[model samples]
Target chain A: MLNISNIVLEIFNILMKRIVLMGVIILMVVATVYLWLSNSGFSEGEGPYLGIIALILVFAVFLLIRRIKSWKVGEPQEDELSKKVMVRTAALSYYVSLYLWVFLLYMQDRVTFDKDRLIGIGILGMAIIFALSWVFHHFRGVPND
Target chain B: MTNRIKEFRVKLGLTQEELAKKVNVRRETIVFLEKNKYNPSLRLAFDLAQILNVSVEDLFSFEDEK
Candidate 1:
């Protein structure tokens, strides 16, 4: 008998498993690509390829963090420690971005501020937030499962 | 603040996990409540009290200073 609740539960489990599996696959692929690019002797300023690579990495890390945040297994729905770590990291990033903006105001006295520079700073802020969140989460006694 | 969560949970023979499931929260949240490490929001306290068959006032008491 195909119970509707049972079928829904099974589908949910399968979807969760697939999401986790996909995260692992993406990490592996990113690692392989990074390694291959580093080994390929691609010189700098090759049509902004390095910039493209960094963008890809930033996106990949963002997805990975989202996956980790949503992950729940073996009795606890959300990890409190991980949540704390994320909050702390985000706070730090916010402070850093604020300081950077203040510094930019000071720089305005010496040079003109442009839209491109502002956009670059925004991207840098987000990248720092993503990277620091992962680093804090990884180091804070909670093993990445 | 003090609460009757532990007493009610015990009376019902429900582990923190079971009560948490009924309340839609993590077990640690229940532990935090029992230990008074965390205070529940008004909505959460109301939900918990409803599930435990008690009024919010019955579930939680304010500290005298507060």
Candidate 2:
């Protein structure tokens, strides 16, 4: 009654669950890129709407990630090592963002750049670094149960 | 901080994954423990000892740390 196929499928399922949040993030990034590429620039009708779309996507991604983590393994997702990794991620992201901001400010004096876009990109950079680092560390450390 | 976790686990014929599942930790945690690279929390020490059917002192020897 070993049911080797069932065991293989079960392992596959856990691997899928582990990458679920990362997959969603990738899809969202692709959608945003597609949107940006199709338009010469945010048109009058779409400019304001882009902000709303970004906001909605951000919230949706946040909620979905939390849901997936909490439900994974039916155990508390934030263990001691996870907390430590998160704290480390946050600290590293802060330093990275700080350096990036300084570089952006320096480049601003040399060329005309949209301040809003630069700020948005800076924030996005920090968020992606923190999120990806956290996920990488957690998954690398996760027990293969 | 050296311990006999691996020895006891092997004696019981448990894989790292099985022991990790029993302790509700990741397999990496067990690997680190076996290599004496990670120290266990007091609760984890108790859990491991209970799982191995041995007292904490029997599982981990700390005189070397002194």
Per lDDT, the best of the predicted structures is: 2
Could you give candidate 1's per-residue lDDT for residues A1-145 as a string of tens digits? Answer: 5699899888678647746776787678678767867887666634364565467576666656655544453343344544654676777777777777777768777887676756666666666565766576445433212
Cα lDDT tens digits, model 2, B1-66, are 678999999999999878877887766567867877666778888999999888999998775433
For model 2, fnat equals 0.00
Candidate 2 Cα errors over 4 Å, as ranges: A1-26, A41-79, A110-112, A131-145, B61-66
Scoring the B chain of model 1 against the true B chain gives a TM-score of 0.92
Best by TM-score: 2
- Model 1 CAPRI quality: incorrect
Residue A1 lDDT in model 2? Answer: 47
Candidate 1 stretches with Cα past 4 Å from truth are A1-33, A36-93, A100-145, B64-66
Model 2: per-residue Cα lDDT over A28-81, one tens digit each? 776876777587665685564466446545744764676465546444444455
RMSD of 1: 8.2
Instruction: List per-prediction Cα lDDT, in the order shown.
Output: 0.68, 0.70
